[model samples]
Target: MAAATVLEVPGGPDGVREVRVSSPERLMWPADGITKLDLAEYFIAVADPFLRAVGGRPVTLQRFPEGIEGEEFYNKNPPKGLPEWARTVMCTYPSGRRHHQLVIDEVATAIWAAQMNTVTFHPWPVRAEQPDNPDELRIDLDPQPGRTFTDAVEAAYALREVLGELGLTAWPKTSGNRGVHVYARVSPTHEFLDVRHGVIGVARELERRLPDLVTTAWWKEERGERVFVDFNQACRDRTIASAYSPRPLAGAPVSTPVTWDELRDVDPRELTIRTVADLVRQRGDAWEGIDDPAHVGDVANAIALWDKDVHERGLGELNFPPDYPKMPGEPPRVQPSKRRKDREDGDYLAPKAERDAAWGLPVIPPVSPMLAKPVKAIPEGDYLYEPKWDGFRSIVFRSGDTVEIGSRNEKPMTRYFPEVVEAVRASLPEKCVVDGEIVVIGPTGDRLDFELLQQRIHPAASRVRKLSVETPAHFVAFDLLALGDDDLTERPFGERRALLEEALEGVEAPIHLTRATDDPAVAKEWFHQFEGAGLDGIIAKPRDLTYQPDRRVMLKVKHERTADCVVAGYRTHKSGDDAIGSVLLGLYTADGTLMSVGVIGAFPMARRRELFEELQPLVTTFDDHPWAWAEQEAGTRTPRSSEQSRWAAGKDLSFTPLRPERVVEVRYDHMEGVRFRHTAQFVRWRPDRDPESCTYEQLEEPVSFDLADVLGADR
Candidate 1:
């Protein structure tokens, strides 16, 4: 069925425009093939700097019926059979609901959204007739999990010197993936909650002058590995990813728009969707007159540095986006074991001046954040599970030879792992403390590769002693918390795993000993064999409870299940596509083909936009979707793609195809073949199931287990 093609695009100031473009060499980027007529000749070769950075605003599109691995969605109206020069508006939402949306304004509304499969473009920082005042104050920057992408390009050059001391003029870009957005042209005379508290007073003055490389947390479990800043993307129906849009990842990248001297040899995955219309015709619109306002002052000078960090330096207001609404001094959205079962069961003390203000030269308090709680089955008795390590929890103190290593906000990361503070000061007992993690490994060992354990959090101490001797980090330990000269935080947990196995006996070579067991069928078969060594799962506890530091009588469990998938493609729904942000699920393959098995986004947000308006009329975008995306091509590659290696090796995938006629089911718990090694959970929408009886043989084989007798093997 792949035959419908029609073209003659480029018609804006009104010229040619014939556009039917149905399957014009379809592909969309079957890994570097780029078609739908090369994403409509890249918006007709950067239609005037992509309509001067999303023309009259209100936009939202991001669709991808079946390219860039297919199945993407988000239209914000004007989609059904839209054409008369595409436009719409109404909007509103923060759940105060309202609708309509779409506005783009030119290149025939991005070639009528490249003939309905829009690839990327999410405008709206207000404009579409003052949608609540905002003239773009954006920021984004993101990069959490022990951060990287050169730590959001050094927190975007320290947020471009705090938006040049609050006069404003940023503009950066490349959030095609791996963070970095920036923006800045404000003055719509305030509101969108005052440009989100002037981006939370320039992200708390760049987290008080890069305090250990910036963070504005807003949850991801208190963003520990830095570079966050996101300041509710100026709230009022928050939107971003627009400057020349196109980021459904896998090298169809292009959240382009750079400069500040093309960021040290820029390469935002070479801004694509086919070279961002020759990178905006060889760099001309570095946000040309991006709303040109010229302001060396007023965003009320970053809301007077967030009103001097909320009335004189106790810096408040953060943690939003849990689908907004509840804000205003937000601090207690529970967790910390339900805020320590509403406090009062003693033994917490610690706040030594907030652990000497989390180490901006204060010292002494060495341990706190021990939290945990993220359950879901596997807790029917006794406990003591252990194993979890995906890197960096630390604690580790020592006394008579003074060792340190803290973190979880007690900071002093003993100068970034000096061989894990000289192997916990030559294996404990001259006064100790333990609780561990730290990791890195991977030279075949593989426990933590939080991107090579964030290259030992560098600020160059000889690049953290040359990445602690070329990739060497190790810790492990696992809860002992003060051993010699007691203080085992009110004991129990089978006596801190028997004094963390007698303080790691001869803990030499970067310290290790962290196993545990009270058998829950060997902790559910070492929680699916510690995801082949890069762990992050089993931590049950309760062997008579106690050690409650940052509370949450431990729990964790991990690996969940459910799988039927096949929905394919979804994104854009934080108040736009009416709801989605995840779907891409495909499966089939007993050679007949269909593959891609990962994507479900924990749905249940009141059945997420009514399950994309119940799969938006079973959207198919090609032979043509051939029984639900098969006759190869939405980023082709298979004979079961050489038996999937937990993906990502020249990956570049996308999703969105359904006409095999509905089938969903979801629940998952590590699969590996057609993907889903995590996130599956939806569990419904079957329409009497049968997307080819959802194949890959109903997936269940993940039993063989081993963690070498649960970590007792230094083998």
Candidate 2:
């Protein structure tokens, strides 16, 4: 290989930038036998178009000094002797530290970058003048495992449609490897947060439309074989390889921006430095009008799409990159598998059940009652107060290694909650049936996400297993239903409570049996505290009362929590075919994504007649209704079905997906996982409140009292 060579390249309007290349004979593209000098010439040829996309933007170069086959390093700051006119912008990093990053302002800068052995050009989407507000929205379509470039191409088209809906045009490009890059020019008025939100709104919309093929999950484990919409690239200080930059792969492929018309058949790998300028010369620049000042459109239109997503639909801000400050309402940042640390003290990680211990708690299901007046139940003598877990009332049966989770209606639910089954097996005795509420907790264990727990009920075993691994349901055992062969149901509540304590000796989380006391003062504090933390009121079980199956014997002291929910649709009353049976309730997630929380139906005859009269005018046909995908998204993380008919296997599920217009305030005691534990009570129609204000965040209650202290079973 020759040591060095001097090359004079035409520099667009800048006249010329005489660049000296070292080791000009060193093969950068061994496959095509293209050398270092060939790269310098390619950069000069594509300088105009490449500068149009990345010039004036702070850039980081992926430098391969020796060649693509040699060692590489990222060049963030410009070299010591940058050209006189070359600029740099101070950019902040994850450490809150800032550095002056290089800005390729002209064609000469492009050649200089090439001379540094930069195989790729990573440019910020924002110009140097306003680095905080990006004028362009970029989406990186990264193909993950089982996904290919074809998948990314398909995603780009879908993204195009989404962008068009927001009155924006997306320019498609190949990432010069396996991925695709799509960018839309936006007005620079809004800050980085606004642009990032717009990108998330588009990504989430795409994820919804093409869930099987697209993913916006920042967590790597959650993103399966799908095209990841890398919205984080829109964030401030983030950058991507600019058009015409060569990739560091075996083939020196360029990150070539293509016209939308040619996106279908274009192969990314073939667009190398050798061929990029030729294609550009033939088609002119695919981005000729890209950087024109007149072409810059108001980014507000796209921001409005985000507003419509979060403010109206309730899909709030999506997760930010971990290096960012803890964003408001962002889900916990911890990895799903590493969450064991949050609840590790107990038997959560036990390898297997202790079969030699006493097994099978033989007890009948306990009955519960509505005590909208818990204050009245405290003085009723020998009553224990426990927070009503906002989860499904279940009786978990465990024998040896086998565990069965029974729903309140006596249906088999073990399949839907495998982790809970494993938890039951690990914590409880060999043979025991413990009464509990199956709840889903967040990564930090600070809050209960009833909606997340509901996602466990997928028909497919694979999906259920997937969810089990992702969002495992927890069992909050409040009552000891049975103990070994010794039947505890027939025993008094106080005696059964004692046996329950003994049976759950080494039991831990997912099997936490909250200790009860006869003190009325502590009961009052717990009732209010638990309810504040989003838990359903307090449980007050009389000591002398026996377990009563299918009877409301145990007293539940819960304040009737009320929220104004949008009546997205109504189901006919099962009893009388004459009137509307129930109103389907929906709440907005943080990003303004509308989701069905539950339904309310038990209306008086007069109220039912009045509601039917009121709903008739607003009722809409289910065809293409926005809420048509209601049950699919509302019920589980895994798509059970495209419609409601698939929710319950044999239930007569039918309802019209209506326009979301009317809002109603309903009173309900608990949210069992996703949907309301029971039907919500209609308080009255809200004439003043907008349906959008009925956000689910209003229902979140802060977590209190460590489980270890609650159970007195701390490890």
Candidate 3:
């Protein structure tokens, strides 16, 4: 029997409860026959390359939970007494001095039933490689601790200044406690070492500028009489809870967001998920559409927005963390007598783990065996061949009349495809489970546009229904994993296909049987045919393979290329010596429009300097173009080339705003929607070519990367 639990809904029962999960395992792969190694490889494939590009230091991957059922989570323990075998403790906050116990069995039960792979569990600490404590730097001023919010606002400004010099953009997030979590996004070009060093540099600079008021020390013993800049928080694996993540400690788990002005008066505790909606309606989310890095460039601009001189010139104060680590040359910190009894008098860690464990948490053993096997190409004629449609790969489970859809990441995908429900109800066989590709198709032909497919994945149900009317979906099912309560994962591919065909014989609309071929050459040819037809690509599968859940038995082939782009301009610099200002990017638009695609300056100093001089005069600030070449005539907010690089200022301030000029031929691997998904490289410049010729029409209509289909029905 599970222990009883208490649940508090944020903003009342009307509030949203953000779910936070920590998953060290690679559970993001497809559920059908994927090995643990394959999953690890998936992450390594994505993350390791980014790590290597940033100087090859090890950085732990911290992924938050997405799209989980609300009922599947709980906060308070059951009203009934906890299980006798359970170990429980009441957790408390350092400031509020409040407490709560474990014994939350209902939340645990939901998690177990849902098979949620990710949770907000802290990874095992990295001992030696951890970041420096806040106590390491000298102390600063600002007597206002928990006073009017203005004190915090001033502190934020001061901290931003310190971060700016380090070439880091401090993105401010209200902690929903007290204080803020300032995030700085760096190019994946730096590993843990660079991140830690960069964090320290920022902290040290803050300490240097405000030694009397701000302390960069971590040890509480040494952080007396000064506000501490908690530097240890910068450890590579340490992740500040992202927006939408639930915090059990809060009265109601609230995710935090803020406006620059509100920072001065807003109390962190006041921003629970419940209160957030109303605030959002009133002020609007400042961070809306902020996920795309290309749109915002980097955090460098955010740092530049901070007003620093106002903070240094005025009377402001900062309150240091209670348990701040000791710093150099400072006497050990001693807590004020009034606060001694309030500290360390309650339980916190125990209840969090216990409440989570009491509900029979689903334990997933790492799939080391799957990793041991090398990924191989689908053997000749042993598998099925189908064009990999450009859409999300979903595994549909139908138990009786209940149907659920899941993404490759094991997340609830049903919300994004409500229209698929109608098709399943009309066509799917009774008590059956099937695997297939869900693609959005146009009115004319077999060619599927990924942009159209992506449009169907909206969060709103009404919008999805509308889109379904405009562009209906096609379920190209290739495998039958279960029928009439029998798990057929162990069945061979040939048998599964036979079973699938029998099951879907009378399916009504939208759901169609996927075409498969035995010949490898035919399969290869189909790849091009499908591609030319505007479909993604094709997958070749071995016919005799069994359905192994979570194992990679398929291969993906994508049609991709790379292209070189000339450096345009850069944003402001961060705090480090090798810090980059901004790398302005350019590409020719259709009808000879020289549109600015975005910024890209994640390069070493030498590269940055060389590019800056070459492109300086091109900076023109016409009313028609706010960003490009702005400030040629002075009296502009845009920084001058001299400020960008000493060698480039005054060297022909007037740049030839050439008529959509400068041509460079380059290759790109993949195109997402209308833009290159990754950074376009610098290929050789085409000086002899006319710039007008480099129109947006020259950009490819994005090739298809049908990865899902490539990993066919082999595992």
Candidate 4:
């Protein structure tokens, strides 16, 4: 097949062997010895599809260590199996002993070959430093292309001032990658959430000071040109790519630490693995003595000193990353991830008056102007078929003169689209209740950003005011889910939709009429065309299908396929056994713990063989492993006894049983779950992912059963 990529090796294990790919196509998992720069390039190339899915967020790939320390982490588990050539790099030293130093050396070699010069050292985050003490504060900044490093440096200084005002000391370090990291030494008394809050406080202050150029939105899709103050990285187990390591891309790995002064003259793209080592050797490690003990609480107290009035500054109100679920009272940032703003003002309030005048008359429900009646037989063979929008599903209830609007969850969503409430109020004849969806042509026209519409969910009174001015959505009256004192939920969708349209008339803003068609050919064509328009997949409501909240009566088609995987073991070399080099996958059994399922040998060239040799000892005979199990029916092998089983009966084997505690979630296209249908790429470990929670349930059918049923069925 003339290998599909330039780096494909044939007839081998999943990631261990690579083959040539089409010019634009890169291999998924590669053999070990791939440098960080290469790894980065690989990710950049391969992950482009995933990147676009997240709206072009810049991503960085990080590698874990080969081992943690003296304990043989995954000798029997074989973190990930690598080819013999890659494993040879971890040759035994004169002492006849191997150490992680070899893995480090291998990574260093690959880094140089990849032409990467920068390396940021990111150790596991420990509880330390507050945001106040100037000495304890540290900042990591990565300057994007087209932006000046001074912008981040200036942001750091501004953040320091803000944190200092709150009562803390801040320390600054070059991330060795493209960014500079600012750390605030604070009392370790706070949990990750508290520290994040404190950090968010500092970030918000910076955003306020530089509103024209900065933002604290953690979701990449939501942030436009603003600098992102990423406090979410403060979560446990989160790590930034460190200095001098090789990446997965062909020539884009290798991060180098630098002095703040160097940032002024350096371009982030210049920091590749190939150049960082020489640069470090020539310049010596700057800030080498940066390990001095310092206090952390000094900075946190500084934030406490801020005036109550600053709360109005709205400094720390940005969104958090989706990976870490929000804490209570956290903004509803995950519901829909885009921010909306409107430029026109005069027309914003005009619709309310018109709807008010139509109050006594029937109000028009929001509908899919795109759909008409369904045809049992074929008409135009290539026509588009769409489901009729069942009018705006609005739920309104007023308290005195003030009216609060909400969606299915009873969340207060009137703020972002203040105009919707006014229209609703005008259309109602009495001090009554009503429910519908607000539909209008967005400023962008044609397509709708439902995510933008979702921004209306807010609890704060002031946030409501700002949102009203920033993004004013329109009202598209549809089904009256609740009308006056009656709950119409029990009614069929058609009946409710009918009552909705009959109830609202001349209520301004062209009322969208929800309609459906039975033309299968048109339906398929419409599905393809409207996908890019951001409409979630079409629903196959059997004209008879009623409204069922959170039910699968409606089928949805997403743009991609994603799944979660568990981290069963990591590969270590004969040398470096402290830092994990590469990872292995583990699938869960009915009993809960994960068994090593598959391996990903594609690593940056520098860490390849070291990772292989370091992990080789973790291997054991397939027959005797504790976690290893053979599916008697399928003839497939899996892990048994989640604990590391060093001896089978009385015979000593090379492998050891781990605590079976850690679980990770990975995104891949294919899955056997019993083992990866193919090698799985490494994603972040799930500190958020629980090992006991990793069950065989994700493999169940989405259309047929409830999640509870799936889990219970497994039981």
Candidate 5:
């Protein structure tokens, strides 16, 4: 091959132009042995359809100087050595910057791009002339964790139906990755934000129709195993890979457009730079009439759906990309966990001076509630035992009318439980700090309802107020940490207990001092008896133990029972190598639904590897598994599983699906809602226990008792 060659490209001012292709023998797809000249030739072959898709649009060139394996950069600015025949369009960015970008007007322009090592073409949804108003509404169907390309295809079909209802003709194309991209031609009557809202409206409707199979969650943690309808792709400056554009991947796959009927059977891998040109020649462009005036959709119709979403459904704007400026009506830019943390920290709720002033006492906010360590039995000798409250650990700070509830993590719980704050102001000492648990009673008022208590932690002040009245939380003060200006943290437990009881004597219904017993026999009796009232366990504090923040100075004893559970899946250890990190356990509900009970972790490295090998034969796909909703990769973590907690947010949640034929016995403390209160301890494999027999019925249920009795309501 020659070092360079000149080819006559059609569609020039003079009918044809000679474009010099330097390094024609240099490989563009090294693995596939495709040379730069081959790329230029491919563009020439598919020129008609390629120009229809990207012609007269501001196009970005994704270039790789070496082959696909080397470094790459996106070229928006017109590069050096620009030919006078090649045209450029001035484009405005979200950051208020403007620059002239290359426009792919003809075959010669595309050939020139190929000569510059351009592997992919990303074109704006608008024409070069009307750069501010988009003529096409594009939706990117992305498959989230536990989902696959097939899921995105399903979502795309559903989306097509949604667009059809709005009188828009939809076109489908492979993303050249593991997703799909759908587009609809619309009248350029609306600006970028309006078009973005239209896309959001359509996506939200698609999610509503196929709630199980699709999602519109902006955050990855909340998406689960569904195809995510990416509404933000229609925003200003965002673009998708133009049809017939080659992707910078192994084998040089192309983002090829396909007819609705052909989509189901089309194999994206088969449509590549080496083959797409011929495929386009054989069948013609699926979007042949996309730009026809008769086929153009009314932008007003799609915007109408957006109006309905806002006015009738109360659905509002979604989060924009992080790089964009904060948009109105959009939710907090941070992830849910971080947003909750910010709310808990009072960072979002109030100014620092205001929050500081709200804590009217000497003990400021963020007083870490003393923690407890678990013990097998209630310890003897100089110990005071109290019923362990199954609620949020909180520190109540009150100077007078103002009160602030501090969480164990030193965040504000004051806003979440407004009822508790009012109660503390009304009943507790004028200036005092008390460590307690914020709990909500069940409907029957017999047991504590942790679920309802969790519902109190809402970001919306209106919702919080509504829930506070509907599901009022009570503060059960257990220890006195301050009185007036006195800091009682250094005071002994015995002294604190006396002071706490004295301080809360004759307090109102919502506020009460925790009952304590010095006798071990009574403490043991209360441990089993209080479990029925949804009390967590028993906490025993030494008489001389001072109030130590975040320290496990107290001992706790809780009920523990073993049950055979189905081992549905296993997450790989963070260290990788397919080592078993934890096994997800499930139990059959009364309705035959397999409920995720919890997980069993904390295995030795040797046992982890051994279990990985042991479970290999039983590994299965999500297709037929009962927990098919949980799609996961073997030995890898996923966002679906990482949503469990803030600490576990970075941990791998993806697990290899098991056949649910194996049953293992696990020792659990108790149930919190449907799952275990803490990580269950592995007992032994129950080969004799049938997986179908592993139902919630087998677990021990404590007798119901009035929580008021535990709090000495009658006294």
Candidate 6:
């Protein structure tokens, strides 16, 4: 093979132009042994349809100097060696910067690009003459995790149906990967934003039809096992791989255009650069009539559909790409988990320093929740009594639009419960630090479900957002730590409670001021009746005492019950010694299936060693145990390890299974769903009780009561 060669490319100014191809034998697809000269020849073979698709558009070059496996870069600026016959067009980017880009006017220009090692060509949807208005609406169907190319194909077909309803003809092509790209030629009467809205409208319609198979969620975390309709591809400066453009993959696959009839069965891997030229020759271009005047569709109908969605359905503008400037009517750019943190750092909220100074607190945030000591009965004194909320202890700080939920250990939890933040912003004072409990109502809408509440504190922003809507949290404000510049921490409990009640007056559900009374008889009655509503117990606070952090200035009275559970397993102590740390307990359901209830682990060091020795004979393999499913489905969901503690990251959670023969009585406060809310204390060995008889029927069920009643009316 020669080092260089000259090829005569047709459709130039003078009918034909000679373009020099350098390194003729240099491999472009090394695996296939296809050379650079082969690429130039391939362009010549598919020149007519290729020119019709990208000739008058500003094209971006994806080049690899070596081969497909080597380092690659995107080329927007025209390369150094410019032929006089070729031309450049000035285009504006999303950043509002104008620059000249290469325009493929002839087959010689494509051949020259091949000589410069261009493998893929990304063409703008607009013509070079009209850069602001788009002539095509492009949508990229991307299959997220747990989805496949078939899902994208199904979404594309539905998208075609949607476009057809809008009087537009749809064109389908493989994305050269595990996705599909659909295009519709429209009259250049709409600007880029309007065209993007049209695409969004079509995509939303497709999603509405195939809700299970398609999604238009901009966040990847929220698009669960579905084909994501990527409407952003139609935005300004965004482009998709042109039809007949080769992708830099192992097999050198091309983004080949295909008819809707063949798209369902076509294999993208088979449409490689080495075979695409012949395929184009045999079937011709599937989009040959794409540029015909009769084929051009009006975007007015699609834009009207979008307007209907905005006006009637409230389905407004979706999220834009991060690189673009903040768009009007666009949602917040931050993901769900970081939304509150971003607000704290952004100028949208009042500065923390300003809020602190205005609140007159030495430390505005991380106000330690006042501790409580266990009491046997309602204390007789000048005290205020309220039902104890069984949820996460949090101190909420809000100023303007910013709301920060601080955990018991002083960690920022603002990202986890977005609903509570929004509720606080709507109902609470403009600036205050309120002490409250973040709780979630159970599926029955009756009691507080601590398990569901725990599910809201997830790391993935997408999961947090989904759970926020599905299982929204509520804020039960108990005390006011700070009100405006008046630091209420030094104020007596009576004054602070009165101020908190006044501040939270007229608040609504999901944000309420806890009910309190000065009557001891009412407090005693509430302590007995409120447990049915999933409240932990009654908290009696001394009216004369000031706010004290980590001090037991208040008294808590909770109900304690005993349950006989099956001794199922045991985990070793963290000290790496031969001692048992926790004893896993289980109870039989009505269907005779053993379920893990909780663990008991408050034994002394000597007793731990003794228990380890006593339980060694009962040890059994997981294969022979009822909780073996925990090992089989480790990450998805395991009963034993479902709730992970942040402080115990990387801690060994595995335990030795035991024979379900031994029964032990343990003391617990209450139930959180089916499991115990906290660690149970060992009462005694129930040698007289049968493990099979120890079922959920033996447990007491609380009477149903609405959570809204517990939160009381608006006042």
The backbone clash count of each candidate, in order, is 24, 33, 100, 180, 1, 0
Q: Which predicted model would earn the best TM-score? A: 6
Ranking by lDDT: 5, 6, 2, 1, 3, 4
* Local accuracy of candidate 5 as per-residue lDDT tens digits, 1-715: 3557999989776899899998888788988999999999999999999999999999888999876788899987666566778888867666543456889888898999899999899999999999999999889999987888888888888898888999999999998988999989998898999998888888888989999999999999998999988888998888888998999888789998999999988888888987898887888898898899877998778788889999998888898887675556667766887676435332444333344545555556655677787889899999998899999998888887877888877888788887888888789989998899888998888899887887787778999989988999888888998898777777798999988888887887788778888999999888888899999889999999877565566899988999999998888886676799899999998888777888999886668989999999999987877765444444222234444554345544566778989999999988977888789999999999889999999999988777879876532
Instruction: Tell me which of candidates 1 and 5 scores higher on lDDT.
Output: 5
RMSD of each: 22.6, 30.2, 24.7, 25.9, 23.1, 23.8
Q: Give stretches of model 5 more than 4 Å off.
A: 340-715
The candidate, 1 or 6, that scores higher on TM-score is 6
lDDT of 2 at 657: 61
Residue-level lDDT of model 3, residues 1-715, one tens digit each, is 1222232212213442322222323222223332222222222222211111111111122222222222223322111222333222222222211112222222222222112332222211121132212111111222234333344456667886765555554556555444455544444443332344445455556666667666655555556556566654543334344443334342433335555666666676666434555565676555553334632233332222222322453321222233322222223234344345444523222232233223221211110110012223434645676665566666776654666675665565676676787678678865666777787654445455566777776756788778877887767677776677565656687888888878877654467777677777877776665564455556655667655444445555555554444434445454332334555445655543344543344554556566556655555544445334454454433323323433245433222232233456555434544455445555566787665554455555634434234332332
Total clashes, candidate 6? 0
The C-alpha TM-scores of every prediction are: 0.25, 0.47, 0.39, 0.32, 0.49, 0.49
Q: Which stretches of candidate 1 lie over 4 Å from their true place?
A: 1-35, 38-40, 47-118, 121-195, 198-232, 235-238, 241-287, 291-711
Lowest-sum lDDT 10-residue window in model 5: 631-640
Model 3: what TM-score?
0.39
For candidate 1, the 10 contiguous residues with the lowest summed lDDT are 355-364
State the lDDT at 607 in candidate 5.
85
> How big is the RMSD of model 2?
30.2
* Overall lDDT per candidate, in order of appearance: 0.69, 0.73, 0.46, 0.43, 0.84, 0.84
Worst 10 residues of 2 by lDDT: 349-358
RMSD value for candidate 3 = 24.7
For residues 1-715, could you state the per-residue lDDT of candidate 4 as single tens digits?
1222344322233532342222222222233343333443433332222111111111122332321111211111012222233221111111111111112112222222122222222332341122111122334454544555567766766775776666555545444444566655454554554455556566666776888667766555656655567766654434454334333343444444456567456665565444554565577654443344543445445344222324655333334454333334445533343323442323233332233323221221221111122233324432222332212345565433556665543445556566666765666535444544564333555444444454555657787777666666654443444454454545665666556656664454422333344587656555444433334334443444443332333343322334455544554534455544456666667875455565655555445655455444554554543344454234434433322433234432223334455565565423332554445565555667776667667753222112121111210
Give the per-residue Cα lDDT of candidate 5 at 424: 85
